[model samples]
Target: MAQTEQRAAPAAPAGHSVTAVAARMRELRASWPPADGVAVFNNVYLTVTEEVGRNIGRRRFPDRRGAATLDAVFAERYLAAVDAVAAGRRPPACWRPLFQYRHHPGVRPLQFALAGINAHIGHDLALAVTDACRLLDCEPAALEGDFHRVGDILERLEERIREELMPGPDLLEIVDPLTHLIGSWSLERAREAAWSAARILWGLRELPGLAEEFRDGMDASAGLVGRYLLTPLR
Candidate 1:
């Protein structure tokens, strides 16, 4: 598949609103070929963001503003990475694997989808929670409800993603490496760890040096997991 250039929309004055974020995702989905790893991930994430937006509109969250704020901030991290790659700059470690292997023919679409999820949920979610707290002038505890609600949405979507993307038995053997690889990571577990990391990051806010170090470590760790998830199965 030929790679298409993906340009991110300008950041909103207050950061990207959910609507703007969704629009940018839609643009990427349209511009990139379906087989492109980033587009594969973009489609799944777009569905997740759209669903979250609907839930927020229906007042499903106790703190609607907080949920929206968290959702937007979380999305901005991914978008920032995309923007970086588009501009020929290096993205964060957590996002590098997907961009680097996006065109690899040996990797399956399912791996592409999960790799993106691993980077976003494992790395971006924690930082987003902290960012949202700072923007809302609240603590991580205040956003806990919103955090879980968003996570609940992601958990549900992950099930659907697996069902929709998993290869048939004819295409994948029982002992395939992809099977074991997929089984190794769990979105639910990732969410739990993300929540813990968010609280830790919030605590480290008072120590900039320690906080940056922790953030860098988290990014690199998630990127390593992403690389594992994208391991070619063919």
Candidate 2:
């Protein structure tokens, strides 16, 4: 009799239309419904991560332009979401064309930085898992085995992230082989992760254009998705 192997179930699909998702994000800002903020911020992570898998699903992986567009949307939106988390205010500034999605003020660039960092997290997760799957996809049957190692690596990442430890090299085993990929670290141990996390958020201030773009884009993109989280000042 042959032994069986176990694998991670494919990640779930993104739930909303891109524009609908974007629109709902705006509604979160516009209404300042705390629940909505959490929902959209969660969406930020879900959409970006799944988008990566979906890219693989398409098998054509978007060209640089589409990728950039997606990146811009992610960066812009995540920053707004983070600022809302920080300021104890709602997130705002969403955009589309031919209309102002949101026009709130007082929260700006931090929002954008927040958006970018969050996007980075989501992208990295997708890159890791998708590549992990791709790697499993490539191995010869004899060499092929359980995705348990993959699951273990991912679970370790989640735990270390919770504990704020610099995960050992095992995650590299999972994500490193992808064409071009990188992993994130807590920068400090568990006791320091929360502090480092704040610093990490603060450090984002140093990134080129993060401060300014977040400020400007928060309001500009309001019509986009973030506006839903705040009350639009008329």
Candidate 3:
């Protein structure tokens, strides 16, 4: 289910709201020289590549768009922390923690949750890359996907979430997400699966536990071919 709406509280002390920050990115995008764009692209490629490698071929990347969203969310327009400080408001984005316990002053639990969802958007891109790498044993590098597959993957996860029947290693002997897929994902297919997982997590199902088991199993099975079809890309 989506989040409930929030009441208008005392105007937030300062830098706040994903909306506020998104505004700034627009401004930057407007002025950035054409040539400079390559830098942004390169940075994304480098980071994504590194993360993919670090995860040992696993598909846990923040989507390129999601990463950009983070940049936007914290931009001066949205939550411009520095400007807010100068203007006697507050500050903008930082790498505190993905999850927080408070919703007062600025960071609303709802907003935080929203950010979490948004953050996972990037996972799709990474997911795609990971999938390709796993199957091909090399980067898909430039493959993309169509929407129907993405939609289907999400639909299944949704069914699992709504029914609260996400399979588990304990009862069904079903695998966790890390090893969930049977083989390397085509970049497109992986992205879809990833996107669905991202959205489903917000529903607060038993995803984390399943994720953990997947994580553990993958961690143990890095770089070795095994019975599991999707062995976390290592």
Candidate 4:
């Protein structure tokens, strides 16, 4: 994804408040048509975030504050990605493909949801982890437990997506492109990369230039996968 106009700010400053990110996402869903790719992904993400919020309220995680902070910061990154796109500032590499193909009628809702998830998890997640650390004044190691809990929720949500969105059994041929796409991309793999990236970012926190370079590379690589995921099969 080539950079176009520069954003007024990079995807929500490092510590931008996340208090309204979920609500903003909900608003986006309401504002767009149901078939809109961004709206489709927004709806799914909103549900996951809402669930996380509810669980946080219930004190489900061992580290309640960490969980809340992680969830909030995590959401902020996605919202920022959208903001970047809206400003025509060239959203992160992972997200550019989704925004570009958002209104393409040939893309399925499931594809939209998956591409968004891929971008968010593969790219935003590591950065979000760093954001949480900055806000909480803690180390990434301290947030590992919270990260795992959130990852668990994401995994379950992915399973639900498959159950609800996959085509009927009769149409589920092994050669289907969607099937191949799903099988090729692993959320677990993304989660692992996020952890490693978080640690790397933390280690390079003092070297802002180097850290930004790593982030850009990650974004571009993830975006490439997203583009592949969004390939128009029809």
Candidate 5:
């Protein structure tokens, strides 16, 4: 997507509201250049948050509150990272690559988008699930339905992103390095891993030290994958 003329940053969201999150995404999209890696991811994520909001409004989820809470909490993780970067602080390890490479001209838009997805789904989503569980006073199982519903939306959107952002056949041959690089990551597998991590994190909730260590490991591992995903293929 082409970037629009720069505009003022939107107001920070007052709370965990999906509408507010979507607005913030729009603001970021308007403020950043189209070629920026973070902007690329933000555009994709904006579409997702909008779709999720619509689903919530249409009563797609059996538990509306749970779905909304989960969506907002999940989005907050990404937005907070954006805030941290703007404040000259380091974001979580999983998000470091995307922010670090946001302006690299060699990274394709699709690569940027996928790297962001990997960081969010691979690391942030797990933590978000546990965060939501704590806020809602429930176990991970209680939010399983909502989690899958959100994942389903993400899966469909990911397919669309690939279809839209993939380079043309003439530009991308069967043995193209870019093709192989992009193919190395899978959203399905990431989502599965995130779900497992969420369960484990939830189980270790009582053991704060162990949970923190596990969370740190998850963050670092996801960051590693994200760095690879953003590998310059041009």
Candidate 6:
């Protein structure tokens, strides 16, 4: 079940320099135990962020500033969620499941990565887009292309993660619950949901009450799915 609605906190901090964001991630990585679920997800995210930064530096993204800002803003939300958990506060509904089950012995690394992806993409991405719009003074449509481009990078990374982290073929039998879990999620679907939520949140921006309601609904729904994804399977 989703937790009670959180007081509206600013989704992204103002003028959060990318350098500061990177430093925060590194600090978290260094501080957390490697086996902790949040740390596992953080490691994967840090790699992706590093790659995105390198790509931005190389003029890879057509709208470098937009991509960079979006990435930074998006990352800050995740880090904030991490900090909330570490501080013994309730995080957003979308994140509570992951923290609840982070250290469960039956949950594998792949599950940890995917659960984090689910919570981040399903809940955080939409807010991040809105946060980016506020910072960039642009519409969500303007950021659509950049979003897809980043999604493509994420898809490739997901494939690589599966190849590198999945248990050996011999152990992953058709009867394995892991196989079913893996089959149940799609990066494509998560991206589509994020896009839809972004538009909805943007449309409701003027109606703070309605926007907060919608955001909470999205958060609860994502949390529910995340809980399913994190189901212990040994």
* Error at 191, model 5, angstroms: 0.6
- Global CA lDDT computed for model 2: 0.33
Per-residue lDDT for 1-234 in model 3, tens only?
112122211222233323333344344445544224222222222333223222221222233332222222222222232245447653222211221212223322222222222223323233323333333333232223322323334334433332342223443444533323422323344345544543344232356687655433332332122112212222
Q: CA lDDT of each candidate?
A: 0.88, 0.33, 0.31, 0.82, 0.88, 0.85
Superposed by TM-score, candidate 5 places the C-alpha of residue 181 at a distance from the truth, in angstroms, of: 1.2
Q: How many backbone clashes does candidate 5 have?
A: 0
What are the per-residue Cα lDDT tens digits for candidate 5 across 66-181? 78888888999999999999999999999999999999888889999999999999999999898888877889999999999999999999999998998777436768877888
Model 1 TM-score, all chains together:
0.92
Q: What count of clashes does model 6 give?
A: 0
* CA RMSD of each candidate after superposition: 6.5, 19.4, 20.7, 8.4, 5.8, 8.4
lDDT of 6 by residue, 24-56 (tens): 889989988999988888888888887776666
What are the runs in model 5 whose C-alpha is more than 4 Å off?
Answer: 1-14
Q: For candidate 4, which ten residues in a row score worst on lDDT?
A: 1-10
In model 3, state the lDDT of residue 148. Answer: 35
Error of 1 at 8 (Å): 23
Worst 10 residues of 6 by lDDT: 1-10
Query: Count of backbone clashes for each model?
Result: 0, 37, 12, 1, 0, 0
Tens digits of per-residue lDDT, candidate 1, 128-156, equal: 99888888889999989888888888888
**lDDT value for candidate 3?**
0.31
TM-score of each: 0.92, 0.24, 0.21, 0.89, 0.92, 0.91
TM-score of 2: 0.24
Better of 1 and 2 by TM-score: 1
Displacement of the residue 190 alpha carbon in candidate 5, Å: 0.6
Which 10 residues in a row give candidate 2 its minimum summed lDDT?
1-10
